[model samples]
Target: MEAAVKRRVEDYSLMDHATQSDPFEFYAALHEQCPVYRMPETGFYMVTRYDDLRQVLKDTDTFSNDVSAKDGKGLQGDLGVLYEEIIAERGWAHVQTLQRTDPPEHSRYRKLLDRVFTARRVREMLPYVDQVANDLIESWIDDGRCEFNSQFAMPMPGIIIAEQLGLGRKDVARFKRWADALIALSIRKWSEPEIRQIAETELEMQHYLFDVFEDRRKNPTGDLISALVHAHGDDEEPLSMHELQNLMHQLISGGFETTQSAIAHGLWLLLRHPETMQRLRGDMSLIKPFCEEAMRIESPVQGLARKTTRDVELNGTLIPAGSLVLTRYGAANRDPEKFECPHLFDIDRKNAGAQIAFGAGAHFCVGASLARQEMVSSFTALLTRLDDIRLEHDLPQPVHNPSLYFMPMKELPITFKKR
Candidate 1:
């Protein structure tokens, strides 16, 4: 094996774009030296070890997901306050629903979400997912070359989630804009003006969704939005318009972006390991394992913030009460203690499905099933339809956009022969 890059715990910074772009080395360093390292810039603690993260994730009481209570000192910092203010001015105030809430309250929302995003629903949508993947591949297969992210990755999940939300396939571009605006606030650094501009775009989305919510309430259309609007059938209290808005915020952003990252990274992994690609091309049975390993090696949702409810020590390091702790899923997924040759992309690895890329415990991603199906559907179509898949060498080295939370590829230029 090549000598590991010499790095100190101090050398890493989540605020740095370059660090965010390629953090695996830093994650490896964290695994070896500082399993729970405090960020000097933001004063937040990063828990990198797999067991440590599982502890944090499972013990929601100790590490609260109700980050709104922290007064906007979580991942986005004071920018979260600015965002809330902007939305409150023009639209419903942000509420803690699925991703933001804790315990009993969260269970209420989760139950409703589970009803709509059920296994039956995802299985039923498989044909549509397959069709979307095929349609996207067909669009560029004849051209022999395409920018994978813009042309295929972004749209496959986007159109599915859009039509499911009753936004219709035609409004996928608008849905993308809305999702991007919401995601930008969390993942990127921005100036005051830029923050305001992004917040305004979020408000635009809120207003549009609000109109949809009102329509769904009056006349149910059987779409996901309609189901969410009328999910409670008189026995339980229905989700308020405010709660619905926040839930929609989570769904839209969660639905498309992470899956896009996963699909793009899956292809990138195949391109990097031609032998693995060849093995996969020979046996489509390996596609699911390929997806699992892709998610493990290149986690899309790298980390999410949790506020400590009380002072606690993790791996000999003490974290104070009210301190923001980032559960580094990307780091934990590569922990050498958990997986041998942790950095190696091994599709046959038995524990690949155990990766917490979709998170673990109660706050585990609600759309995980859909995301998995989307990835499997995507790669199954891509490998079946295209031959000689290779990257366009002239493009930039780091294809991923800089993001603190997500590992989204900005573009993926590649050439392939239609098989």
Candidate 2:
């Protein structure tokens, strides 16, 4: 008998596309041997333990979100330089907003965002969300088979966000391309030509958004873009054009990408676990918990970068000042120390809500509630309208696209009977 090869922390490469596609094994190894691991290829530290990540997230002062300071260290080599040359020459330069700013500076943007993304707004939007879900389902229910990601998952949220941003549902295709371009650099390994193309697309989006912002400012429509344009406290100053542009970039990316991933993965999970699907069909009330567990298992925004403000020791690992730290939310969600049988897909798991899939503390995702509602809406519609959902036999294996930043499935081809 051959001896089983033991895995070491050093054996894993965070930059590899294959590893990014299925990283649970790496997460397990990091959690066991080194919760605070430094990548040999890039020297970036990754924090994997649940408690340690919470601590890092909470201590915003010690762990900053200001990634611009370390510009060249990002995965996109020379892309930042290209961005400056391309964008600054034609349009407004990108500035740090909600996801990239820290402390009092972050507070300014957060207050405005909180006002725009209010709970009442999300509540009011629920009906429309359900309508979109059903409408998309109606498009493919007759076929008894559909490409879940493109046909349903991608467009459902895409149309909603486009309409909310005052662009109307007709522009969803362009909106998706713009959003994809905005996030392309951080998600995967790209060639030099591809990087330039991404930059060009970004410039195109900047110009398009500039025109929209001007229109919203001149005529204050009550859409999300209008709210952002007019939002400010009596004491605070109005946001500059640079600020608004960056905010739009953040909103456009955050509004749909993660939610799309969540919706697709939710159905994929149920298809994989027929018993869970039957249980959810019986009790529909468990849909919320099912969404929570789905996000916990396959977090959409897998890991985000945070720059250390000063030298700090975390779980006995000493990290230097101004170093990049990747808080692996995907890894933390599955830490054996945090959850019993971490790999099991238990919809009834009591503490499933404790997962930091939306992150934690000051920088928690602002669209979290909306994302949850969308997931609930999508799954509820699927269960109500379809039966015996199962993966198509000819479908490709390893469905998920390889991405370091986002957990996007390349495609999900499923068949089901209309109920």
Candidate 3:
């Protein structure tokens, strides 16, 4: 595969556009040619193959997840100085928490997160998820039309995460504003002013979470926040205030945005593939794999950054130490070597569960169980409650999130009969 390489490692601009429009094609070419290519412009090594990406993620010792304070993933290197200034002005420490932390800190946080966010806990919340889905559907069912993304796909996860954290449903809008800012910061193209605005908004989010944590400490509502406030690490020392705030932000942003994007992208993919949709609507049992397929085909998170701790070799290519690396999950999921007929939307694909939409290794998404349950409950309610559901806009706009990190339909208007 490496013998036919024609694209240079510095051709990131071309790759960026290709990724935005059709990531599978771009990655397919890379996988067959330069599976482990470095980007000279951004100081990142782009790993597109499935096995190569997995190797980087699993070998945490060799690939440090320690992100720079100003730009953790280093994708936004252009704004590093500005970010440093912002951190200085705001008294912020850009420490890696949860997803970005390497062990033993990653192990410590994972254990604590798992305690509160277990599969059992997620299962217990199924009824609540169903109720939320049904309620959202009820609001628009009688109207005979709805913008699914805005009405259901967007707010459902936000509401669930807010309630889980003991925050009010009324606060979801604020949560979204904060979430949008964080996602924007991850995008490489945002201007310095835009990044500054996000930094300010994040400061606002931090302050808000601080208030909530204090309230949870005093009142002890038994929600996730309260548990986190009192929870002690393996060292038996309680989580510091900074750690508490960082974890809270991660939960809020990760829990709400990614799942919401997944649901939206799932619908977009299904609507475009009616046979798959009809099959899922009929069998119902296929919904799980159907969602899994959607995740693989249009992963909400395109990729995540990892920094090399030491020199590493993958697929016969050697990456030097201290280089930024990007794990292209969107590309890896579509590798034909990993999945048969990677382009097709096959709900019955046996290995659909192997998709790393929620990531893998020790840093796999903690809210995965919760997200899956929410999606299953949502699709169940959506398919059964809306009859003859179809897209309202012909040739609807392309699916793209505001940020480069995510890919989701900006607006998905649809019409259906009230069942």
Candidate 4:
């Protein structure tokens, strides 16, 4: 690096805090000074600029996801990295089941669930999706005031996921809790005892899904889980018990929060920005762009973690091997150089397709189409049925994770004007 370039690098350790709510300021600073930043505390490389994030995420070879951080560094002491060797081996089963795999294995596992989420299948699922949304609207319409998060946002999408996987709605509360913990655990540190409790609960979740997969093998059903057991009509290797359970875990986990947050957040966006909300309520066609803008403004998943394999130059910064490389999907979506008035929530803006919310490349979110459909169905149903939907109170400040993986709301109360 040139002397001037070396001088531009700054320490971002001071920005790390337990009580921190908004870390975007750090991201903005990093974007301006250095697209590739090294946090002083954790030593992990942070990529904020749109091009840089795309570069790293698209090249998975140099940037691996096995997550053995380089030189024994990167997010050290995080409870997520505290597992023993034995636990680490067990966790490999968990990891191999989803995000950690590469190429052929990744392709094989991803294909099993792909058919259900493709555009054709998503359209087939739409009537059922609309029914689910309308059912929630019916339940909440009489109340006039509702805790929208629990009453509507949480239930409808989760039930769709449960049925898709051959699970029942009875597991909603437990499944929701487990999903939240798994996402939050990236940033939230827990006591030893609490970690043990969560581990045991995860085991229970695994076992429950395993039982469903096993039973389906004996009595074949058409559900995704059963099909996976029978290789889903694919000539690829039939999923082992571990692979079957893990694949189910990923599908269920992906559906649990991304759809919930998207529904809750699309509503939050419509409620917070009066002009956008008014425009959307008036024009039915803008629903597509509105969903696009909401995702850009408030992405369901914040960032992705990758473990680097070899030294590679990214926008003049050398990312050493085995380091955790974070592609800031949330931050990149707001890169002003790429999107005009990036911070403003305007659905009419051009280049709406430029947002990185669903991610880029082969690792892109598997359920992007399903998520978009759910948002469209839910928003259309809400606007058609509920006379008016607006915020009943101020949105509690949005939550941020040091892990930068989720944008979850604490609470959102809503009032609906009777049609």
Pairs in clash, predicted candidate 3: none
lDDT of 3 by residue, 112-228 (tens): 888899888888888999999999999889988899887899889989998888988888888888877766656656677877887888888877777887887789988989888
Model 2 C-alpha lDDT per residue in residues 210-243, reported as the tens digit of each score = 8999999999889988999889868878898889
Per-residue lDDT of candidate 4, residues 213-297 (tens digit): 7799898777767766776563556777767656666676778877888888888877777677677678989888889888987
Sorted by lDDT, highest first, which candidate order results? 1, 2, 3, 4
Q: State the displacement of the C-alpha of residue 21, model 4, in Å, after optimal TM-score superposition.
A: 3.7
Q: Clash number for every model?
A: 0, 0, 0, 1
- Which has the better lDDT: candidate 1, or candidate 2? 1
Q: Which prediction has the highest lDDT against the true structure?
A: 1
Regarding lDDT, does 1 or 3 come out ahead? 1
Residue 216, candidate 1: alpha-carbon lDDT: 93
Model 1 Cα lDDT, one tens digit per residue, 1-419: 32275878788777887788888889988888889999898798999999999999999999989877227675566777887787887899988989888998899999999999999999999999999999888888899999998889999999999989987778888888889988886686678788889888888888888899999999999999999998996789889989999999999998789998898888988998999989988999999998999999899989988989999999999999989899999999998889888888899899998899989999988899999999999998998989999998655646567888888777889999989
* lDDT of model 1, residue 375: 93
Ranking by TM-score: 1, 2, 3, 4
- Whole-model Cα lDDT per candidate? 0.88, 0.87, 0.79, 0.71
Q: What's every prediction's RMSD, in angstroms?
A: 1.4, 2.4, 3.0, 4.3
The ten-residue window of minimal lDDT in model 2 covers: 1-10
Winning model by TM-score: 1
Cα lDDT for residue 147, candidate 2: 92
* Candidate 2 wrongly placed segments (more than 4 Å): 1-6, 394-397
